[model samples]
Target chain A: MKVEQILHMIGGVGGNSYANNSKLQEKAILKTKPMVEEAISDICNTIHTNNIVVADLGCSSGPNTLLVLSHISNAIEKHYCQYNRKQPEIQYFFNDLPSNDFNSIFQLLMLYEEQLRENKAADYVNLYAVGLPGSFYGRLFPTKTVHFFHSSYSLMWLTQVPQGLDEKNCAQLNKGNIYIADASSSIVYHLYLNQFKKDFSKFLRSRSKELIFGGKMVLSFLGRKNSPAFGDIFNFWSLLADALNSMISEGLVEEAKVNTFNLPFYAPLMEEVKSIIEMEGSFHVGQTQTFESNWDPFDDSTDNFVINSTLSGQNVAKYIRAVLEPLLISHFGDDIIEDLFSRYAQNIARHISIEKAKIVVLILVLKLKE
Target chain B: MKVEQILHMIGGVGGNSYANNSKLQEKAILKTKPMVEEAISDICNTIHTNNIVVADLGCSSGPNTLLVLSHISNAIEKHYCQYNRKQPEIQYFFNDLPSNDFNSIFQLLMLYEEQLRENKAADYVNLYAVGLPGSFYGRLFPTKTVHFFHSSYSLMWLTQVPQGLDEKNCAQLNKGNIYIADASSSIVYHLYLNQFKKDFSKFLRSRSKELIFGGKMVLSFLGRKNSPAFGDIFNFWSLLADALNSMISEGLVEEAKVNTFNLPFYAPLMEEVKSIIEMEGSFHVGQTQTFESNWDPFDDSTDNFVINSTLSGQNVAKYIRAVLEPLLISHFGDDIIEDLFSRYAQNIARHISIEKAKIVVLILVLKLKE
Candidate 1:
């Protein structure tokens, strides 16, 4: 199988509804839940609603997923008790592409099932969760059914790997790696822009149909400034593939089948995202905020195991496992793999700065008009 | 006859080669002499030249014509005496359309004959002032024959009245006035622009042929800013024509004679003029200056004779004299002519700021490549 096919299969795996590996996936969900809760609060205030139906689109399997559900439940419970009135019922939906590991998401929900029942108060709060597996580009719910919607860290993923990348005209020889030529940037940008416009317009239309009057949505995602100097991030995997080819050519490792890879998603500039939303015109802008994060801030980051445990989980570790051995062998010979974690620790202690590991997030909250 | 043809006829009258009456022509020439001397001094200072061959393109019948010639002569003579070297020879070619009043120009030149004989320096000065009556758009002399060229207040005369003004579409309404709608501002501007580009290109090519390696051309004419608010100036003539139609309809004027009337010349923007000169890549920009004439100055208490006299000797007064008087009388009644004049004079007295009457002058110097 081609390298692109392998990467696509992995992306498809994350997108599917049936995958059940919850233990490894739950950590990211837990970490992101508080941020999602803050976003939901802002969204509620924008809509002037104490009770609202919410959906987490692209809600992958993780402990963080239930934490988000719990946050919403707590906010609604507090609003009712303080006002001395009937509490609003909550219906939370977990959505992803059909290929995502939903069993893991389902298991995490089941674990929280008992706790939700025990805390049920007057006006009968309900915890109903369902897995929705489909492309988010089109209508997925009935008209005027949703009150608020939220999505995060997902919009930057391209629908498919770029075609014709292997063609001689598509790639140019630059130093040792095959880099894109002058016309490549425009071609890729247009290709991705067409897909994004189609998908985003459909998403807005679908949401507009489903949203009740005064409903709100909070979305956080990766974007980029429209400048010639910034290359489209869709090419990240292709560049990595080229680097791998160089390592393979140097006889760093035996030829082994590798089918799956991930694209790094970064937050885009505010202007580009605003342009798309404005073009759709279904929602009025409320608030936009940008925040930064440092994923790996340890002083001695050279201990690969410690850093991996702190920042990411098994999925990243598994992917890096294949390349790590080959990469270390090629650069420092076979014996260094055992001591590589110590070397990384020392290097991190000596040179790593907190600023270098930061990630930027941009949040946009919009309210749907009647 | 078309309006343009009428203007052409008037312009043609100033091109005649022999004098019909030398005495009256000499007096007009004398009256204009001082202005010509000042103009020559200004030109010399602008071009930084003490000795140069100066030709007046469209010299016509004027007392000031000899002054420009004599000024060139004096500049050369003074330069030679002061530097102890041979003075520059002056070859003054006075040009006009074939039908010009050249007899007057020649007679005025003859009146300076005795002064030339007494100078003694005239032998070395070598003044050869000749009449070249033809279109100034094409070559009239040998290559590199002249050093300076001047034309004042002449370019405003259009080469011909624009064609097709009598067409049905050119009439804005059925009342016999030409319609500005069909013959729009752009249409009029472009019509003149086409003629200018054609004529000026030929003129430049011809002048380039006659001008020495380093020569200067000074041109002054009536112009206007290309603004829609100021469209009144260009459209006013049409409105006056409409007023004439009103008079004819009322049995006060002859309709048959109106066809003979025409706008004399084109008024181009400063940028347009500069572009035409620079298009051939033969000349560089030297200076451009614009000023508006103030027709009134007093606080509405003085007689209006000053403003009236200023307009009397010019072509503008002669062209408007026929239509203006009747239009005023018909509109204001015979008894009010004095009142009309008094109102105009009062307005002038109140508002005759010097800035209003200023003219625009653009000077360009070209260096011929060997």
Candidate 2:
């Protein structure tokens, strides 16, 4: 299936919706707040125009979508105050795939406006929010128009699942696995890496054309600390694969289905991400940082300990389900979702009780080269 | 209820959806195609930039939304070819209330892009479509950015249901009516007219700020040919009011509910419309036309003859229901919608059998004053 056609967070404000389960992603945004502020300040100082076009690429709906806007606006507000400069008008473009829940974003904007009115006086920044629906892997704006771009927890998604993984008359390259795992052969790892390289390079080139020279972008997404393909992030898919495998053994699901399914995502090493950006040759990396976030968003401990493993496992599973359930349903159908996730939660509980699980996040502040 | 909160065409592609029953609106768009083309030509000639921004205000979802885009692009394409000039990039913003069905529009956009790919070469116009959700009664764009604006069949909606229509312990201004019917008091007529004047002036002021000096706008909405509060358009609301009264007498609906409810809409005469544009002072009226359309969209007969009045009545009722059902449900509850429209259909059929009913539409092309 095409990744762009089906990849979207669970929509609306239901119990299982992405809006409710996006704390893990929000932490990453908060982690990079200083970087975002610096980027906005740089743009304000360099770009002399009074109107700035800022876009949030892959801005899935909910409070987080507006959270990004608030960060940028607050930064601009602070920058103008510090520099004693007149506030500029900002036109914010919240962009994502066509199937993303833009309705939720529009609804949140009304409340955002009301809150802005209550907090700020007449001298506040004039902000206009618009929903732009399309993939960021291609051109999304006019040339040299956007002044600042921000994306969070979105670039790991490939434009499509890796091709050539299913050769004619050959077993699937990543059989019994949905992502790069220990069981997967070297060829499987390389295929996923190549897809990421192609998608990320195309993304940079597209944004470079859209951004004015010296325009700034702040991007944060999942990555690995080490150079190896099999890192801590793989545990997410491995546990999910184990659940599907158990279902297959029970004759509840087909083994062939598990073998054929693969996620259109890759958690690349920090080195690999840096190399691709250099190879793309359009952006100058300004600031970069890598940090570890626990699999369970609620577990914010400095040491390697999993307190209440059962609850932590459920929290991790819920967050993952919010991000992946729609894509899974599109491929595997709805009947298997409940059973698969429950077993996956049980597996996570057992595994984390023995050892803590962590996911690495990478944040970057890049500027378009003149 | 706030008009912006409750006023939206029936959403989705269901049986009662606006998408399925917008032939009357489509006819108005086609009739004004020449005016839209001329406006595009004027903008292309006067504006020196290769990137033009055009907005369609109150662009509710469905084929009609894209139809406006097609009209503008075709105009741009033809003008460039005739002038032997390079085709400019057009950024089309589709604006509507937050309650609109923008998801349907985004879904249709994929098909639009695919069709463009198949039908044209790479040299065709670069069109980027974005959805802007908010009321057109306020500013929606940055200063001096928009080059052309188009709105169709949407301006008849007042900002609210004429504030002060209900006073403490006083009789309803327009008793036993949902609009300015013949039985409506002069005070009721003045109330609706004042609302329209206030809303239309605010709309003009907002668009004038968004548009570049000398930018053009083409607006078409329901209007009367002569200067009178009770024109041909009154039949539409009088019939609907009669239907509600029937329900009130049958105990299906309450008298207080019917008395308190009035449509947040007005159809002004040509003189009133022209006078408001002159009073607004920011626009130079270019071209104006008034025409008649059959109340039964399917009845194309020129003479005052009603062939198969029942079918015609049902078609008319479906069209009106597509636009008003949601608003009615919000005010009177859902239990009365099905019965209300059926009774409205019967009333329209009886009225048209005696004499054909018609609706007047006013079209105008105005340019922002330099």
lDDT of 2 by residue, A1-370 (tens): 7788899999999989999999999999999999999888888888787788999999999899999999998898799989888877889999999999888888889889878978889535388889998999988888788999999999999987787664423346777888889888888889999999999999999899889876899999998886676667888889999999999999989888888788889898878988999999999898999999888899889788897999988898898899999999987899999898899889999888988988999999999776
CAPRI tier for the interface of model 2 = medium
Q: Write the per-residue lDDT of candidate 1 for residues A1-370, one digit (tens) a residue.
A: 1221121112212422213223222333444455555655554555554336677776644554566567666765665566575555465666655444444555456457646646655323344455554446554454565776777655654444234332334433222222222334565545445555656666777788778776667676655433532433323223334444444566642223111122212234677667878898887877777654333322224332343432332222233333233333433456534443333333333332222332345677777754
Residue A23 lDDT in candidate 1:
27
Error of 1 at A166 (Å): 9.1
Residue B102, candidate 2: how far off, in angstroms?
Answer: 1.0
Please report how far candidate 2 places residue B23 from its true position, in Å: 0.8
DockQ of candidate 2 against the true complex: 0.68
- Alpha-carbon deviation at A123 in model 1, angstroms: 11
> How displaced is residue B34 in candidate 2, in Å?
0.9
Task: For residues B241-308, write the lDDT of model 2, one tens digit per residue.
Answer: 99999999999999988888888998998788889988999988999998899999887889989988
RMSD, each candidate, Å? 33.9, 1.5
TM for every model, in the order presented, reads: 0.37, 0.98
Q: Write the per-residue lDDT of candidate 1 for residues B33-136, one digit (tens) a residue.
A: 34444444444444444335577776545554665566556755564566575544454666665445444454455457547767665433255455554455
